[model samples]
Target: MPERKLTPNEVSYSAAISACEKVGRWQLALKLLDTMPQISIVPNAVSFNAAISACEKGGQWEMALSLLRQMPHVKISPNTITYSAAISACEKGGQWQLAFSLLNLMPEMTISQNAVSYNAAISACEKGGQWQLALSLLSNMLGIGLSLDGTTSGAALSACEQVSAWQPALALLDNMLSSQLLPNGLHAGSAASSLRKALGDSAAYELLDKLRELWEDNSNSNSNNNYNNYNNNSNNNKQPWEDSNNNNKQPEVRLWEAGQPVDQQLAVPPEALAAVFDVLSDVPGVIAIFKPSGVTTEEAVNELSQQLARQRHVSESVDLHIVSRLDHPTSGVLPLALGAVGSTAANWLEAQFAGRLVRKEYVCLCEGPSLGLTGCQGNVSTPLHTVELDGGRASRTEVSPIGRQAFTGYEVLAGYMPPLSSEPLLPSHDGEPGATGHADEQRPEGPELMLLRVRPLTGRTHQIRVHLASIGRPLVGDLTYGAKEASVLSSCPRLFLHARRIELRDLAGKPFVAEAELPHELEEVLAQLQQVAETSPEDGHQS
Candidate 1:
């Protein structure tokens, strides 16, 4: 195959032309256009149309328009596609004047009128907000006996939304059905969104019923028996590896061979140039000639329905997910880990955590050197916040103090609150001699700190944080509720929060527990605070 060039035939030019178009190389396309006639390559309408399309894609709108002006001199008449691409170029360039003018003049120029041509014109008008003009053109399209396609209908509906024309939107929806075009969710969304934005929340709320009804009806009629039969392949209703052909060994490609419009391009767009791009890579060219055998329009629609059902199945399956997201942190946020064990596992996990049947421990700063709030931040009681789930239910969170909380019965590891702490001095009091002396200062008003092996009876939101704050003692740095001198107590830089541990009953009701360490940040802060408490008697407030 010594590069058998076909003497610069239209086919060769078309291939080179399309390649240039796909890559957005307008200069190369123009250069190739110059070379076509050199090798006796007569420039047909297809050749020029492709070059124009290429130019449009390259953002050479003026150049593409120039090419159109040059169409008549080359003894080539602009076809529907030629004008369509030209109009599309004008639309893309935001040259609405040119776009509208060309569309109006198409008939006089004796160019054809097709769905693509109509779609481009309507979209331009929509983009330009020429609602009245666009509507007039759409009505005129019907007057000319060209049935509106989904593209036309969808654009009209979109324009309706852009212009805040809900009445026209409903009318358009009715027109879509009357014209036998199926209105999809995008169409419905446009109308609904417009209504919602125009009307208040209450009015928006009412549309939900109509939306629901339309969606149900649409879904029911959307699929054929073929899809239903395929779905029945499993009683489980889960088909990960499904499709008539599991093999993607070969793909089909489509090439526009001649004056004929590419069939693949004419029909619904294929995901790839080939029937399959990935798995079916080896397959030959696409189904180019698409009279579709004996497949009538209705049958084509049915097949389309089948394809859509499969795609929807894929879309729906992909959409199915288990996610554990935290709504807000301060109120308490659950780590995304919460969703991993869901449904039955989630329910079981919730039960054991709520029961708090499992024992726990925390190394807290007890205002004692032995207590060593170092690395072991002061412990405070906190509860797993109850989360309102879909059905208005609660789920428990598993947490513990800084370290491990194990064993059924709790035991204190170490630490104590310094006794004889200074109490708040009363302003009116006549001070006693010992009370006034530095050696005999009153004890501090707040409760002393100590290490404790406490067990929780229940899990509630902010249970630990709130409970500790409530008991005349809060974690050294917790300020969410209220901690004594918390605003200035920068010792523990963190809120003393930790997932700490989780406890739950296994399938057999056998208890299981997992603990996470106090992250280094919390540990470091605790170490410094404990050291301060040890050095000064007043540090622990020895009165």
Candidate 2:
């Protein structure tokens, strides 16, 4: 456009800066912002906002503040976005005091404080280990009726977790549920971690169980409401599939039988569909079950749908909608919507996942040489992209710069050393076969293993596995990502990954939480590791 004699205006320059902001090109974004004024185009708030946001993403807190100061010099007033970006930059740069100062300055400048600004400030406090300050800001935000989102709650919970402030964290969780904000795994996990730190393991587990029960009750109540609403709507709309002649008859399965011959049938036997899933929770419009390893999520859904149809005495299977899915080798809590495709309950459940309002937590056994030094807890923010394999028939995710954002946080629950190598055991003094020396004497030197509590914020495919692998700590039995380790741990049954918990909202906007205990196989593996640790010289305990 410039070559064609059409000079770029403020809009064009701002657009270029915004594009740079998305990819964290702070240098280029700042250069563009500087060039705008040189070209006689006055930089507006939009132009500065993009540049500051780019600086924020690049962790350039000083540069972001510099841009904010430059705004007033250019005769452009800062807005909420401008201040929020600057505060967020400070949060990322671990400058909690600067973040608070920016937040406090917002109101003085006649700008209304929004959730984003408060969230950034709270997160900065969280990073700074100032739980009291974080809670104070959160209380102020709530007192003023400002929007409280997951980020706001998460930051507060994290702050509390850092200080082992279990009571306040629990209160915040209760407040979240009362306010009808859906709490996901991260929120619950943070609170639980705090509780465990302050009280004990039993107390934390008890709290989670109670929470699940409370959410289940809420879901049951809302499921009834949804069923009533659906029935009322159906009666009013008079769906075409409904039989006018017989009100009690089931809806016709005309769509399924349209192209098939009368004699030729799509048969699915009742016994074949007799899936004996361990029902975790069975409310009106939702069903949470334990999906075992080796079964694909689709197969579990199909079998459950058929079983539900049989129970309802319908000739065809019900259209059970899948809200979330786990890999074929993963086993845990699987929640499914128990209604037609576009029904209120199904749509609500689908929306929770699509909007990322649902929270999922997993447990896995990860193996790596540096597992001991990887710390007791950390987060992986590596972006991931799915790539095709075997001529596009299969796919897997790998860390890539051009990929979409993905985050996975992990806490080490326990650690264990691998079994001794294949060296022959010395003969016993009593003439018995057992003569391996002390565990400390015979311990093998190889990759360390850990039991990890994992929470994946963004639900990318194989996110936990891929992210862990990217950090050199892959799941022990993950054949795809830990193929080299799989040969060594041949006794492992399958991928040692399980979706342990899930949190969601029903059609009535009530929160629903559920948990699936570890399968016997995985539990046995952990038990063996515990036994090994107990005998080892340096008991495998996380710092």
Candidate 3:
């Protein structure tokens, strides 16, 4: 039988061009587009759109514009999709001016501009560092009564992040929450990025904690109501947190204290000392403490300073400065400096961090069975960077490649495969008051637990969390990154990371080391896991 070659028509050619576009073969797409005329098939708007999209994905800005310009010559009218793809091509190619020009031309061509068109233009502005222009577009959209979605808000946040405009970023975040729009990873990341630039590391972390608390309060209330409504008609109407096996057990009180103003919160009570912190070492000019989870490093420093003053009979003038910081939910060793040491000691301590002279070691319970990780010991050097999103727009934080060169070395201490629980978990990022998530699509399959000893070679914002998530093993109880739903299923109530050891040198280059044991929450979680294993050895399988 002789095989016959079917003639390529508009539909077939459009599909071929679309296939090429998906795979980012712009050149082939263009070739296929040109071949349509040779085969006597007049290219339609769909064909041009697919070709332009291919160029957009391939970063072929000029070719995309050329294809768009040629659309009219071929007697094909460019629609909004055609123009939007062309604009996106310019956006990706850093051709903001051209993108704006195309946007302006839409009105003259009697084509009404939509949110997609404006998003592309705003995104182009963001890429080009024209945040003012991007913001203007957003304001204009609102003036014209265009309803903003996550994408639109995300783009605006990204624009604010580009310029390190923390005030605007915070304002936008507050607006999103007040409007009951969910704040996803991008939204939080961008605001955090701006805050880090404006308020330094510790304050930024504290601010994020406050924001997350507000969102959680709102989300929990709304989600609980929704859950009650969902199960109202069922015979076994129950709260989501109620476990079947532990039906009779009293609800476990979460250790995470609701955040309060540092001024209003009283000094660390003597009876609550263990729950607050463990003093690792107290030297003349430096102090180290094991900060408990749930409290910001700044709050810990403030309270601990007062405690030190009372114990040593020193005046409050002995100003304490945070020499090392940990995320709010991260419990671990934190080093501080006494102001009496003056700027010399402060500069020296800061130098150690800047030069990576200090050794930071952490232990974390990550979501992994440790399979296909290559070995028990390995290093991850994934470029950790921030991304900002508003509405539907996104832009990477202006971290240079060099700035993002974060590195972490890890050794898997133990691997335990826990059975997947059939618990119905709420989305971790369900921060909006009224927004809901689709059922858990983040269930882990096999070995659901891994213990790792980690040493960060280079420090960046969320470096350890980012690195672990990049390697498919996000930390337990991490709402950000990929561990959201998994964290909900785990018994750990906070990010399962602890800064256990720190090695550094004091003034005059004298070497020293400080270590802190795991906090009560972390230790208790581990003890529970051990008890479970003791009772049910068949429950866990080695990965």
Candidate 4:
């Protein structure tokens, strides 16, 4: 009898692809995936995700994205695993922006983002030197109640390391310990290692000291004392990925050590619990507080709830509902509904934001005072879109035809040229030495900056930052959009945009407004600019 052959079904093809994936044979796996349809075997999500995993392990990012896009064309919907694998591939290939877009797409596609997907996207950002974005994503994770694991937490540390953000790196390690996540040897070492590269030996040792103090504090006080003992042993401090038998594997490489330019400078911020926010408004069933910069809206809410509980002399937990969220760098009027979960007060406030009945007002300081944007007030009705740029760090917001239509009305409040610093605050447009020319001259005329009162008719991720950047006047400290380097504005360590006011009608049909005053740091910056304007050569020195 002749040898009998069976046609390869989906199961057979999937198994073949899995084998290829296990062995890092990404090309073979892709070819098998392609051959399946040719052989009349329709590929499902399982087979496609397996191929993506193979590509991820083999660092085939472009192929992974292609496979992911092809799934929808074939009438196959991608699940969480599909997106996670594709994101992992992008991370391996240093395509952090692409990975972020895919993660964002999951929510739009009605698939809930899981810890795995977020972890992969964060790892990609870490690899791409988008430490700010990575930290922001980590903050978002807690808002959604996703559990942070070794992989996710370690990626955040790596991102801080990439930028030499020593303070945030240490803060993150301390956070992990407080969260009971146990800072592993790998993450701690990476933070220290990156600190050494960024700020020199003194900074790295300083970080090590902070880590030791944090470990000791947790050891002396935490109820789970056993978890604190891991840091005591010297020889057993192995990285999470290392094993006793696999001593031959070189540790993951650091990009900074490999001569890649640092992405951005990050200042060490005070702990969230230590921040004190001013009370803006105390309306019925609602209180508006001035949310400080450098903390997520969720963290602000948590801290505010604790403070309120303390003032009430209550030990039990209280549910404080956040009506709307501001970005970590954005300090603004954050409204909190003090009520039980699903209370009518919470629902009403939430409904206002959902229905776009709430009005928000922002004050921003931006570059390019000479630009015509400061000439008058008008509405910027351009539709905005978020996209992954190949030559850019993280994702960028752009004007696109298919993007969500947005409206922002703005009028220039004031404009001035601050005294030039001894060193340039913004990075030079050309990479050559002192392209800005402000760095070398005596009393050089600094870049013109303008303040604007902005009203966003539509809420979008990075709406104000992107809109302003699109009009050729990016915010002073907004490194992500169009702000030059952090050194450009040495006085302002944060994005010079503030959500000064918010207005809404209560559920009872009563109109109300909540507002936050300018932060002290912003006030100081403006004050200095005012002094410079008064003493400028362009203006007769006026008292």
Candidate 5:
């Protein structure tokens, strides 16, 4: 417009600033906002709001607040939109206190608070790891007559999930139902994850079934009222296990009866347990299965034992002795002894793990390009202490001097760098800003990942996870020890640690080895990384 001899006014400047905000060009937006006043075009609240929103999208919280403060100096009173954008900027920056202060200040400034403002504050608390404060803000919103929405409830649920507050997470879901807000897959998934971590796989499965039923009832009601034809059509046809956003269904396991043909057993449809437990090795007294992620090790063993008894028509209770165990999210070789608990075979198998005579190798994808890791091979000797959380509902391992001794050997396989980009490759949240219903759902930009072959010499709770994180390289989806990196790479479905190989003596004292190939999902992630690497320049680096 200036080149055409027409001086751009505040309206034109605001529009241009908004255009920059959409593309996350916060610096350019601020520059344009500054230039407007130089040309005798007095900036208005609209101009400042656009610039503030631009900063928010760009994750420049300080600059956003600076713009907000300058608005008052320029005789432009900050309005609801202005404060909301500023608060959201703080949320993106992980500055929960500042976000809450801004929200509280709004009412004193005569700027009425809205759902957007409250959502931003609540999300900030979630990002800041303040679940209690997030819940408090959520309660305050309801007390002040602000009706709950998916965004509000999702943020609160995410906070509870992060802390493994299953009770509160379920309460929040119930609240969403009472408020007539249909919980999405993300909401249900977060609550299920919390239950899984705090209770067990059975509890999570039960919750999913309950939520699915509620969703179906709500969908039927809406369909009868002609509320949303598209939603009813699209959702009604989906399977009970399928999530709307994520279509991957949880695979099931089918246990075979004794003397059953291998081919026939494979042909049987999955039942008994809702996971893929591929039998790797079955000896006289030792049985090893590839335990898929999302099912606890104990749950897998118990279910398998019960299935075996039923198949054999045994009236007595069947108990499988667990020789080795893995975390709920860790997938791979899990060995169980078929002999009685105190039998010679069971004692021998347990002795191998207890005495560190067995060899266990794991492959994991961890946050990297780490300078500290240095070579192709390295070892970490750290004392790890497990601390109970939420009154023993959960626990986490940390490196401490007074903790139990733990050692891990690691060999770097490959490093995958993300494509170079000035802007984030993934959205900060799923649907909209501050609408991430689960902490594990948000996908912020992350550094390169290092695929490593790790061997834990000393068996301790979270040994490998804590050791790697102690050296500043945390696993991709380990929220307990590496919450920061896990949040950055939230696209990871679960913890990227897999038991690739296990070696121990069998019943006859012969050397036995069981190996499990990497799961298809993990392979897909690696394939995408390889594709990106081949397409990008060798020197291309994340900015």
Candidate 6:
């Protein structure tokens, strides 16, 4: 450059100061501030603020602090822009303490940190995974004479969602609602689906019903307005009333369809459960429930006959377990659960007589393909048959490839561990808890693994256990499904099989869905998997 000529205008001075600040030339920026006076120009508030920002952006926090003190010396007062910018720069430098100090020093006239100011600080905390800190900042933003806009809450909620913190994520959504922050489609979908999974059937139905109501109200408003316009036009033009009637009818039908409530929970209360048995007995299109026990056949017959009589279904007897439908061999039983009185006693007899149960399904955690023969990955392409403990009931199960349209889906939770800690677990169908019966089959050593999220579409007695075992993938600690493997999983403690979800149609052909979560034992096993995955990198497990 041919020796630079100086322009002494205020605009010229401000631009030079900005250029110095942009390039981290804090010393040069300060020099320019001082040099302005010698040029018969005074340092304005704009230039002073620029010099302070430069010091902060250049990592000179101390110099930035000192420059603020000199602002009054130069007869320039700091505005919100200057204060906010200084705080933001400190935010960028990870100097939150200094940023907060400066924020407190600002004019105590109920200052509000604009969107830009709070976002920078929150973003920094998020980058550091300081979730608690980030949350505190958000509360302070709202509590200290400020309200959070959609963007701030959205950022915080997104962090919570990513961490799978189900409850907090839900609360944030609720808070944003008070701000009238309408959730975009993606957020609504995620929040609804998550609420469904975490809160279960009742909550899921409530969310879906609320969504339906919202859409319904919108449609109804539109319908009412349309009908009003139609009626007005018909009256003014003397058009046919029939045309208006038809138009109104179409909209009313549409509104009703849109407004349908999703569901009503059919959960049987513990006390009303006897009422369920009453339904079983009284349901139409049924014959007498059949049950057989050697010693008490007469009493059993009398009581079951009375149960069926109360229901008004014909009373008869067959050597079987009473059930709604007995479409399959194992269909009549109460899931081999032995929850009924006495093992293989009078109640088991009723299951055999009902003869109306359609299907059965099982939920089991089979090893993934990575486990080779032991994993759920490979297909056996063969059927397997095993004898029952009674040596009288022969059980058979089949395995095929996990088909795409089979309606059976398994979501691998992507981790493994011993099934559960040594805490006492649930009882078995035989009225005894775990580690009973085989007594000698407990494993001596080694970690056991449990898969997650196994769901079955069709019900077949012992279907889940039998099918999984056919492919050499036994459940972690299933005594019946894989007796030998129970020992293998002895270290895991809990049986990894859970009846996660059941889907079927009622007698009226309407669909029904029920689900149960993993028991505490399984949860403990998953906790172990997480710990192992965290501590051991060579395993290369990413969860």
For each candidate, what is the lDDT?
A: 0.47, 0.70, 0.65, 0.67, 0.70, 0.44
Among these predictions, the greatest TM-score belongs to: 2
lDDT of 4 by residue, 1-543 (tens): 014566668998999899988877788899999988787989998899999998887767898988988998999999999999998888767688898999899889998899999999998887667899999999998899987788888889878866667667766765666567655445666666555655454544443333333433443455465344334334354432234564524332111111222111111112322346677766555667788889999888787777655655789756677767888899988877655444444544554454345679999987742322233565566677564433122355677643554778787676666555523443223222211111122223445677888888677778988876666567877877865643345457788889999887543335679877788888888887742233233454532
Off by over 4 Å in 3: 1-6, 222-543
For each candidate in turn, the TM-score is 0.43, 0.50, 0.45, 0.47, 0.48, 0.32
Error of 1 at 149 (Å): 2.0
lDDT of 1 by residue, 1-543 (tens): 127753557887878888888766778888888888886778888888889998777656798899999989999988889999998887666576788898888889877777777788887787667777778879988998989777887778667766677667666766765555544544655555455545533333233323333333333345332121111133333221112454323211111111211112112233432232111111111111111212332333334334534654553211111111211221111211111122222322332232233233332332211322222323333322232222233333233331121121122333334323323421221121111111112322333443434344333454554444433334444545434452324344545444344343332223444444555665675454332233333455321
lDDT of 5 by residue, 1-543 (tens): 868999789999999999988776788999999898788999999999999998887768899999998887889999999999999989877689999999999989999999999999999898777899999999999999999998988889878877788778777866665565655656766676666666665556555544433444443344332212222234344432335564634321111112211111111122433244677887655778889899998888877777766765787646677767899989999988766654434555654554345789999987733322213577777666675543345677767643554678888676666534312332221232111111121112345567889888778888888777766667888877764533445667788999999987665445779999999988877786632132123344432
Q: lDDT-based ranking, best first? A: 2, 5, 4, 3, 1, 6
Give the TM-score (vs. native) of candidate 6.
0.32
lDDT of 2 by residue, 1-543 (tens): 778999899899999999988876789999999888687998889999999998987768999999999888879999999999999989877789999999998889999999999999999998778899999999889888996788999999888887788778777876665566645545766776676666565555444444443334434444323211111233444323223553524321111111111111112233433356777765546768889999999998888877767776989987777767899999999988766654444545654454344678999987654333323466788677675443345678878753555778777666676655412221212211211111123333456667888888678889998887776667878888874534335468889999999987554334678899998998887776632242233666523
The local distance difference test score of model 2 is 0.70
Error of 4 at 211 (Å): 52
Candidate 6 per-residue C-alpha lDDT over 1-543 given as tens digits, one digit per residue, 9 for 90 to 100 = 115764566677878898887766778998988888887888777887788777766656667767777877878777776776677666555566666566666547355566656655665454344556667778877876677676676556544433444455556655654455433323433344344445443443343334334333433354433221211234233211114344322111111123433223211222322432221221111222222112133344345445434554445422223332222211111211111222122222222211111233333454422231111222222222222222223344444221111223344344344445432322222211110111111222233343534444333445456655543445655556564433434555645555443333321224444334455565676665532242223454332
- Mind giving the per-residue lDDT tens digits that candidate 3 earns over 70-126? 988889899989988999988877788998898889989987778898889988887
What lDDT is reached at residue 12 by model 1? 76
Output the better candidate (4/6) by lDDT.
4
- lDDT, candidate 4, equals 0.67
Q: Assess candidate 1 and give its TM-score to the true structure.
A: 0.43
Candidate 2: the clashing residue pairs are none
